[model samples]
Target: MNASRLTDHTGYWMRMVSNAVSQEFARKVAGQDVTVAEWSFMRALYDLEPVPPSVLAEKMGMTKGAISKLAERLLAKGLVVRTENKDDKRAHSLSLTNEGRDKIPVLAALADENDAEFFDTLTREEHETLNRILKILAERRGLDATPVD
Candidate 1:
């Protein structure tokens, strides 16, 4: 019988690259006192605000409990505000505070910087091909773009 080496798997190599990229980005965003998941959450909300937690959960492919927990942390950080609907006692929505909105661009810059640091090694065509391949994999796998991988 013969067994393949650990590096023989595609997932092994993908994980190697992913861990490096993710860890570096996590460090860069840590300077902002935000985790990568939190950054992803905030970035998603930046595009769709005044949204209910349920809707956000669906859009981010996260559970309601997870969204609630993230929301609580962001709320405690004074980065977001929740507004209760006047006509519905159980209905509420969230939006970013001015500070949170202001930080979006700065956080986004950090994200961009992180990408350049890791991916700039690839030539333009190589980068494009890699991204296209990844996107195709994501689409075929029904993966959301929520950055939770």
Candidate 2:
């Protein structure tokens, strides 16, 4: 029986880089009064306004409870609004408030900056290859959940 070293697995390295990238992005967004999870939720609603909570949950690959919690927070922050469904009074829809719409471009800029800060060291070809490989692995593994943490 042979034991493999920690460095023997590509997953270990991937996780290390992923953690660094996510943490820095989290920190950046924190200054903007939002979490990465909130940013994801806002980004999703940026173009698709007035979507149902259930639809958002499905698109984000999150549970309804999770989406509801985030929505509540955003609502309190005046970044999102909820309205009764016109067709179904029993259901409700969510959309970004004017403030949310304004903040999205700033948040998106932070995301772009975070990616550059970490991945700019890689050559263009290396970056493209890495993105391709990661996408393939994610698809193959059926890992569709948005990274909120």
Candidate 3:
């Protein structure tokens, strides 16, 4: 069977593109001292400020234990802080500290650069079309396209 035949399948193309783009993005972020998972968690925090670890786990599609570990690491790095929620002491809210807040924009800029590096060859129309299609898939799959902070 020819591979081109499978190219018409959305899952096949999505995985191929996602894997390639993410690997290159991981490389770009490596110089900044973060793994892809850390970057993702940070970015999520940026989208939703003062979110609890449980909320973060849901947003990241990660386990609470994993989120707790990452939160601890980020806290140690002074990038994020955890505080008891005034209304519920049992639930702690997380937010980016001055350091965490500052790093997000820089990382976001790097993301833009990475996208340009890979997709700059596409025409504006092509980019728009791709975005539109991808957004539809994201919506259908219930993917949280929103930033986590």
Candidate 4:
């Protein structure tokens, strides 16, 4: 194949793999009544005290508006609490509620299962190589290395 054609072919395969992974994880998580994105946000809040939405945005590689929206949904679900920042009168901070905190391990388990289900075909070495490549891509793309909050 020509170089351009090869690039196009690889891109298509990349999207196919990505979509499959994402969809499968979403399906696995449906039982928990949480979307992948919501779970990501909750996982980010795990182990941390109240944090500003801006910090979440930076850590999650999302916009403050998007974080706020996610927080709103989490709040409605009683999974997170948003409160005024003690130090910053105008800014708000968010943290997981007791219920939300308790759900992190469950979601993490689901995530682990999701990975195992999809990537189990790969040998340990292959999985490690894939992880290394993906990490490189994330850095190249300027993506956040921090876990999604």
Best-fitting candidate, scored by lDDT = 2
RMSD of each: 1.0, 1.1, 3.5, 2.9
Specify the highest-TM-score model's number. Answer: 1
In model 2, where do residues sit more than 4 Å from their true spots? none
True-structure lDDT of candidate 3: 0.84
- The models' CA-based lDDT, in order, is 0.90, 0.95, 0.84, 0.84
Candidate 2 accuracy as lDDT: 0.95
How far residue 109's Cα lies from its native spot in candidate 3, in Å, is 0.4
Q: Which 10 consecutive residues of model 3 have the lowest summed lDDT? A: 140-149
**Structural similarity to truth (TM-score) of each candidate:** 0.96, 0.95, 0.80, 0.86
- Model 1, 74-100: lDDT tens digits are 899888899999999799998899999
Residue 148 lDDT (model 1): 56
The local lDDT score (0 to 100) that residue 110 gets in candidate 3 is: 86
- In model 1, pairs of residues that clash are none
Give the distance in Å from residue 51's predicted Cα in candidate 2 to where it truly belongs.
0.4
State how far residue 87 of model 1 sits from its true place (Å): 1.1
Give the runs in model 3 whose Cα sits over 4 Å from its true position: 1-10, 86-89, 145-149
TM-score of candidate 1 versus the correct structure, residues matched by position: 0.96
Off by over 4 Å in 1: none
Cα lDDT tens digits for candidate 2, 9-115 = 99899889999999999999999999999999999988788999999999989999999999999999999999997788999989999999999999999999999
